[model samples]
Target: MYHYTAIQWIFFFYFYCFFGWCFESTYVSLKSRKLVNRGFCRGPFLPLYGSGAIMMLVVSMPFQDNLVLVYIAGCIGATVLEYVTGVTMEALFKVRYWDYSKNKFNFQGHICLGSSLAWGGLTILMTEFIHKPIEHLVLSIPDSILTPVTLVLTALIGADFALSFKAALDLRDVLE
Candidate 1:
């Protein structure tokens, strides 16, 4: 029943990316006793989190009345996304961003049951409490500014992803 325009979706993506980055960095910083930019992109964003949120938002649209189903779907969807992203990143970057090997019920340290359940619980919270207000806020922006902002943000995100990937691929120094 909730329909979002493309521009609204773009804003949602950016909003979630920055929010995820903040959540991740702060959590890591507290754990390490030092600040950390805990995101794949060099910018203050995390595409994986953003993509995961968007995917769940879309997937859970039909299950609005069924919170339990939404939560279960989120568990599976986020776990798959996390696993695939972990495999692809390790293969491409030759770096492990995260490892859950110490955790119980982890699959190749890529997807863990704890994290999956957390994702599901968060999905329920987001779908039930957060997303509607966010959608309203995003769509409230006037078209005159929304289009330009979305376009600019999209370009910046694209460039950030490319540059970060390029940095990860920099193995010449190691080879030497």
Candidate 2:
């Protein structure tokens, strides 16, 4: 199993969050014909992507040599994460961010087999081909540069969360 420093994991979390936001925003914009954040966070971060990526990384570490197992497990794990995220967001904010109602083999419009496989397949490719080099690059950064950058990002994310949470609460109250 691969073990990463806490700092490295932090780096991965933030990187994946922003990356997810970019991908999601672009895809949603293409579909809706307008720009959209496509993220739960007010900032350019997707917590779900952060969670999913790190979850798969840690989960796949144990099966480093077993590509097939990693693929299967990553798919199932991500799918479950997606479903839970959808349900939790709705339950908490009285909103559903995305619906898979029209997708085949979807459960409660939360998760579909097609998307699950796509996520899993992507996980496999990332874990096998991309993560190691990225991890190496992340680790190579001197602490002098890495620490301050990480600190700034954490502060910004915290501020965004606080403001967004307050707004969500106000909106929820209004809806109620």
Candidate 1 vs. true structure, TM-score: 0.93
Off by over 4 Å in 1: 171-176
lDDT agreement with native, every candidate = 0.86, 0.86
Each prediction's Cα RMSD?
1.7, 1.5
Instruction: Give the clashing pairs for model 1.
Output: none
Please name the candidate that would achieve the greatest TM-score relative to the true structure. Answer: 1
Report the Cα lDDT for residue 135, model 1.
77
Q: Candidate 1, residues 1-176: lDDT per residue as tens digits? A: 66878788878989998889999999999999999999888999999878888978987888888999999988888888889999998888777788999999999998899999999998888787878788778778898999998899999999998888887788533533
Q: How well does candidate 1 score on lDDT at residue 111? A: 80
Q: TM-score, each model?
A: 0.93, 0.92
lDDT, candidate 1, at 86? 97
Alpha-carbon shift of residue 135 in model 1 (angstroms):
1.3
lDDT of 2: 0.86
Model 1 lDDT on a 0 to 1 scale? 0.86
